[model samples]
Target: MKLSDYAKSQGISYRTAWHWWKQGLLKGHQLPNGTIIIDVDSSNHIRETACIYVRVPSVEDQDDLDRQANRLTEIALAKGYGVKRVVKEVASGLNDHRKQLISLLKNADYTVLMIANKDHLTLFGSDYLIILLDQLGKKVEIIEDINNQSEDLVPEFMAALRIFSQKIYGKSMTKLQVSHLLSEFQKQFAPEEH
Candidate 1:
């Protein structure tokens, strides 16, 4: 396909496509007449379109979220994975109903889902998602495989316990009671200050 058509298909400007071609991020060749032809099939075989997914546990981590997205974008670009989109969201990894994530999963534009960490996508069942995406001819690329890294798991545990307690206690357990219980639980496990 012509470079212009390829750029149009990718929803990018001609100049950007030309730049990518020059940077060797795109596979193609220029003819004697200065017309560039893109080897779409070859490029698709070598590099898949990527959708960078970035998330934070809360709004307070907005800066971290931007940093995460930027880092993933750099990685994706450096890998020559044509980045189709970067979806950023402020939501708990334990939350199952993240709107942007759900939407991204349903969208078929990209073949690769790039993320900073597994927990950035979800705290649990990330393998299931990866399997499903694989079944759908899509894949996930984790920049930092920190799955076994030592980190604070108290907040996630408390969130899960709170959810289960709410479900079990129904309307009997008030929000205040849950919060109090979680607070105490956190205090017990929290690291001591110097």
Candidate 2:
């Protein structure tokens, strides 16, 4: 840490931190470039903290989800981070109506989110999730880069569902069906509108 940052962390003035360093109270070093730096973790201090979020595709994969959550929690603990909570879910990452994930993202208790990868959050488009989480002042740490196995199916399924109006009902002639379907879709994924 820089001297200024360390001073801010200790809630003291920069000159006071320099005095502490000169008095041998705080550990620091002065480089040839005159840069002052402080080593903060001499007393086994652990400052990083995170919350774990795990997801799986189905109920049968609950064991895998549990293992992932436990692994992430253990990783957080090993790194001297205060583990806050281990939240697990059994749902498709492409599904936008994930109650647990929504609650976790909205939660203000933890800013760091530990997960297997972006796919564990949203197989459809995880960058959007990252943006949303950032708006909530949280960031993600992917311990393992888990690939999206069903990546191809998500878009294909959405396309099929969108064309269901014309394919199943054989009607492209009415505005009512399109409006009704749009309303249903919004209701399914945008419950906050209600």
Whose lDDT is greatest here? 1
TM-score of each: 0.69, 0.53
Q: What is the C-alpha lDDT of each candidate?
A: 0.79, 0.69
Query: How well is each residue in 106-153 modelled by candidate 2, as lDDT tens digits?
Result: 777776899886777887678877887778778788876445545434
- Candidate 2 global CA lDDT score: 0.69
RMSD of 1: 4.9
Index of the highest-TM-score prediction: 1
Off by over 4 Å in 2: 1-45, 145-194
Candidate 1 residue-wise lDDT, 113-167, digit = tens: 9988787789999999999999999989888846523442544455567678878
Candidate 2 least-lDDT 10 residues: 151-160
Q: What is the lDDT of residue 187 in candidate 2?
A: 81
Position 99, candidate 1: lDDT: 99
Clashes of 1: 0
